[model samples]
Target: MQRVYISDTNIWIDFGQAGLLDALFELPFTFVSTDIVVDELNNPAPAGLLERGLVVETLAEEAVEQLFTLMAEHGNSSLADVSCYLIAKMQGLPLLTGDGRLRKQAAKDGVQVHGALWLLDQLVAHDIVTKAHAAAALQTMLDAGARLPPVDCAHRLAAWRT
Candidate 1:
């Protein structure tokens, strides 16, 4: 079965808006989050729906050690980001994240990264929602304080329509 690793913040927010967490309940995949990600979510900031209960937050001790070593060897970013990337690397799973910087860094490290736009496309492709619905959901996310890039949002909508 496919395994999906999520970063600290981005996917949680997007999934919260798009009801993606509910959809995941039906998929044959395991969801994982790192300790660092757990810390990020436990911040004073409000937690999204995805972060509220959907993710499994447990990391092997060796995995945590490996993550720290990787962060030290490579350029370090946020502990959460590094942990997410390291977990994906160790497990050979694709990371689900919407942070551009993290996505680029994951790619440079040869890790697979899937962002919100990709999730939108998958929702469209799977007929989980209509193109119009997805577009409206994107707008809803924007109105809810999500800072999605205009071009990326437009492209995702256009792709859905196609």
Candidate 2:
């Protein structure tokens, strides 16, 4: 089975709103988070949504080492995101994120990544939410300061509506 790991921030925010976390349990992937990510979440600022008791946190030394290797390879800024990327890369897992810079960095480093849009797609595909509901939620995300392109949002909305 594959593993799906997330960084400290993005996915938690998006998934919290979309209720994707529940759907994640149905997939054949083990959800994981590193010690660095756990620390970042414990901070008061970002208020990691998953930290509110949704998922388990894994702190393996090997995972930490993999994260450090990816950080060295990509020169990433956030230790949490770097650790998430490294674990996914070394273990052949996919990462869930919504951070633009992190996504770009993960792409450059050949790490598989999924973002908010992907979650929206899954919501629609699984009939978890109606097209209108998904669109409204996505728009809400935009209104709440998510940096999605308007054109891309329109395209996705159209596809979902069809």
- Choose the strongest candidate by lDDT: 1
Candidate 2 regions with alpha-carbon error over 4 angstroms: 1-8, 17-30, 42-76, 160-162
* lDDT (tens digit, per residue) of candidate 1 on 1-162: 565656556666666665556554444445676656756764223344345444655677877777666666555356677777777777777888766666777788788888766666676676777888778777777777776678988787676556
lDDT of 2 by residue, 38-83 (tens): 6666322234334433344565777666666656665644777776
RMSD of each: 3.9, 4.2
Off by over 4 Å in 1: 1-7, 42-57, 62-77, 158-162
lDDT of 1: 0.66
Candidate with best TM-score: 1
Ten contiguous residues minimizing lDDT sum, candidate 1: 42-51
Candidate 1 lDDT at 156 equals: 72
TM-score of each: 0.72, 0.69
